[model samples]
Target chain A: MPIVQFTPFSSLVQPAFWHALTDLKIDVLRLSDEAIPVHGSYSAGRSVKDRESGAEIALGCNLSVGGESFSKEDKAPAHSVSATGVFKNYNTIEEFKAADKTALFAQVSDEIWKSITVDRSTAQLSRFLLITFADLKKYKYYYWFAFPAFAAKPAWEIQGDWKGASDEFSDTFLSAIESAQLASPRAFFLVRPKAGSDEPELAPVEEYDTFFANVNPVERTIAFLDPSAAPGNPGWPLRNLLTYLAALHPATSHRVLCWRDAERPAGAPFKSRFGVVSQGAGTGEAASTEKPAAVGWEKNVQGKLGPRVADLAPMMDPTRLADQAV
Target chain B: MHAIQQQYWAVRDYLSPVLKESKFKEHGRITPEEFVAAGDFLAYKFPVWSWEKGDASKARDYLPADKQYLVTRGVPCLRRATALAYTDADEDAERLLSFGDLSATGNEADEWVETHAGRAASTLDSAANAGNIDEIPDVDESSADDVADQVGRMHIQGGVGSLGEIPDMDEIPDMEEEGLEAGDDEATAAPKAAAPSSGVIEASEVEVAKGNLLQVRTYDVMITYDKYYQTPRIWLIGYDENRTPLMPAQIFQDVSADHAFKTVTIEAFPHSTSLQAASVHPCKHASVMKKVIERMNQGVLEEQRKAFGAGAVSPSTGKDKQKKWLFRRTSGPGKDAPALPAGEDDVEGMRVDFYLVVFLKFIASIVPTIEVDSTTAF
Candidate 1:
């Protein structure tokens, strides 16, 4: 069995997001360093295949935020799953650099654990944290993104080679899943055989017990909108989902379906994958009782865990605009 | 047979509403009906371009509910206009200055010159003409001094402030120690301590030197029918390398220097809700389209002469035929005749349906770096 390694989420902060942040800082958050809630979104990953080698190249999962991120009333774009995040805007660069990131990570991990075990909310699985210092005068920003995922005591392992959904399921079954996903996009769901029929149907994760009723635990299949394009691995969101699942049915094996539909060429069928995964004994109980250690601060372009800078002077500074207009 | 067919089309076109009732042939302006026909033709030829129903509140009642405007998003601009080679700068500068003079004087006789010269200047001038004496002094002095001073201040503060602030460096090690004391997993703590110390110091330095050189910007270019101008208008929205929206001034670097401020102005897009974008002024679009249509007509006439002899379709007694002949003679030389593909020329001359296709070709010069039209060969 291959040790399942999940691809980490990469931050894609749209230019509109920065412009909106600048507006927010000036109009609403002047001199305030409070953490405000922001919204972001992620869709199923598109696989970039090596033309010659035919090997699937993992374009790291992207969590993107845009101009609408500041508006709590706004929803994610069509066919994407929304994520909630805490945005901490420091008053100065010194404050941003000197802040305790490790403690910040721990706090977020604790909140996520509580959401899963206490509140039983499935959406909390994709919560993230962002810290920033916006230099409005220069139109430059210094920021870091952290997508925390619990490190399972004994990590989940794949029991067999993953097969494409097209090869594993009939056309009718795949179409049913597609319709369900289109009707309501969710991060996680359960795929069960419809009662009195061999066809498959998707149900929300909250209905886990009723969804899998009278079915064997080994045959039960859990599905998620996978944001990883890598053939051998799933995305980071699946880590905490597995933790939530283990808490529900401790120390059990279940089939996992990684639903990837976004990146396919026009007219091509969905390219989802399915495999078997099992957790270690009593791992679910520990996750429910104790806060698990987490790891997912995004690495910069240099492959180092440091803040990225966006020098937007050319695009945001009024003085620069005046000069260009002349 | 060809001459007879050409004569029949010439007669039909004379009676056609586009020519008889509308001013499309004479003034280049089209009626709303003609605009819809052109839009449909453009959408059919280029699937990349599709009609979109924009914000419902902003939708115009004149256009169809579903086909309010045409849009194509994420058009990759691989290089800035400044990056292109401007080999014909002198000719373009002279032509562009003449255009400015003509517009200032309000002379429509040189209207065709504005169309031809505008296209040539957009292609040849690119952004290098920004260095022309007429436009360079204020921009160079203001931007160069301001940018240099700002860059210097940023380096001094960013470099010295981070290094001099001892607590910043001290805090990383302290956090590592705390993680170890708390029995934190090695998976999380190892990456943090390994990078931030040395990486942060080096990253700031590297960012200062090579930031602009590596990044490429993208543009979302849209075309909509202008009711007042009765011509197709183009709008542009730019994004930086990180997919962040570019400021109005920043977008100037991607527009051809000759057209940037003179022909392209910031205006609220009609289809969008309060979204201000840079749009190519449609004041000259009708003239350019008129010139293009005349050129297409000349191509068909040239083919008619080659196949059926010059005397075969001589101007008849009708006043319309004589007027058309006189207009063609005075329009200009056949040197710039459109290179229509062999055997594909329509006997009735270029259809108004192909209006947007030719319009895009004229616009490609103004936004030389944007690769929106390359996929659809005219």
Candidate 2:
């Protein structure tokens, strides 16, 4: 319900793929700024047809997330949504609550964290349903991600023409979703600085890591996902939420995109990751293993974004983010 | 095997290993005894479909098999007579289709049950004008009776009431009109449930064989929808002990006796015996059933050809490896899947979907049975 300015991919090159997707009439998804309704009711063990068909409709309230003291008839503030605060364990609140209600969340009482708790402040408590925002009939897929809960908006002095970035990223992601035409899809992945600090404290200069798709989880040794960050893992976690859900039911499958080290294109002047665009070497010879620092090129950033060359190499580039080409 | 019970179990055992299941097939790898054990294990994991073999001597009449067995997707259901007794003879007269829903009271599945049960009224006539109704000839004797009798064996060419046809009716497309003008409209309105009403035959009420057996309420409905198929299709193995096909009863089992009196508005086209009898579901799974029937019809063709008793090969015998494989195994089940004709393989191969435990779970959910494997659902 709060208004905020946003930049799409913070002005990256991948927005091109989204531009092609506009022909499909798919909604561009820029959740960082777009308004999303997050109130749903509570209906348990309903009919399969009823549940599947009306899953998007707000459910009626059965009880409050606070203690069991709420009266049986108390169905106030029925709409519910999930928010990241103190209670989310293993990146999902379900693990924390399912473990044991009193044994867990009751210990939390920080003044600053409480001020930002969407569940308690808006719905009066965190409901297990996690207020789903879906249009299966229209979109055909769902993506889940975590957005930081801000106590106060950052000063506008540093903010760019946010609407441009918002529309660009929205169109790009929407294009990807429509292109895939995935059925009953549920996807969740983290976005973090590959060499810098954790996602919450990421700096614009830090490159976002595509670790899930790039690094194999089977490795005995792990790389620090964000070397300069204080809290994220140095290597793929021995465990994670996506892994848990997949293990819960191996019947379903997940599609992931990852990053890897690879050679530069045959004619490219710079040596870079297979797809990631980097400055050209002055000698035009085979590039080095390490990524060369930015040279403020006038051209669009383009190349593969994964372990190997991909079909979308042309559009994966984050254009105009490095420096003003002119 | 003198007693009916003894005769029935013997046939069940014979076909248990070799029964033509949509998902599971008992192949040569397993012995007949192992087939029975595997089948029994399946029954424990899920409700055993309603099954009982037909008359011993007549099994030979329907197919060349040494035995014949009748299986329902679940327990066979008899419709209440009140739903079918239509009181008038007008275009608006009710053409009630389907039996009542048998799901447990207050269960989540009940909502779906009610929706399916509401389809009792149909746009199809009391008799559909099936221009090409292929009648099945009742098997009169044993496999030893004579090879000529095999020519008359009947299998459904399509789903339900229109399962198979009576070869004598040459003008079947006009059969619906003829049935409409008949003096007694009850039989025409709901052939399956058309028996003269005696105020008897309610669901879960009849006690057959004096309650010694599990006749503990064999409840069933006529048709249900599937997400994969996207069509209203009923799943069942229909037939009776005398080798008599049960298409009519299954179709009209839910028609209230009074349906003959109420006027109706034709909303959908005609389906032979299923609630969705109006149209074939457009999905591949539904087409899979038709593909199966088409292959079975090839057996009919072979049977008709064999009727000449010349014992000579057809000049048109196919050279394809699948056809050759089928020719070798025609005597048993599984030969029905002939490789596609040369050009038809261009599409994705529609292999059988039921080899894994997943398909069994799917069928149970589709049939909407009383008990399902709880652990497998998640």
Best by lDDT: 1
DockQ of predictions, in order shown: 0.07, 0.01
Off by over 4 Å in 2: A1-103, A107-187, A190-326, B1-378
- The models' CA-based lDDT, in order, is 0.62, 0.22
Q: Write the per-residue lDDT of candidate 2 for residues B192-218, one digit (tens) a residue.
A: 232123222211122233221111112
Error of 1 at B36 (Å): 12
Q: For residues A182-276, what per-residue lDDT tens digits would candidate 1 score against the true structure?
A: 66778999887776776887788888888788876765788999976555557778888888887765646778889987423223566787888
Off by over 4 Å in 1: A47-60, A196-198, A217-219, A262-266, A280-287, A322-326, B1-378
- DockQ score, prediction 1: 0.07
Query: How would you encode candidate 2's per-residue C-alpha lDDT over A71-148 as one tens digit per residue?
Result: 133321211112222322121223221333222222221221232132122222121211112222221111111111
Top candidate by DockQ = 1
TM-score between model 2 and native: 0.20
User: Interface-residue RMSD per candidate?
Assistant: 15.8, 36.6
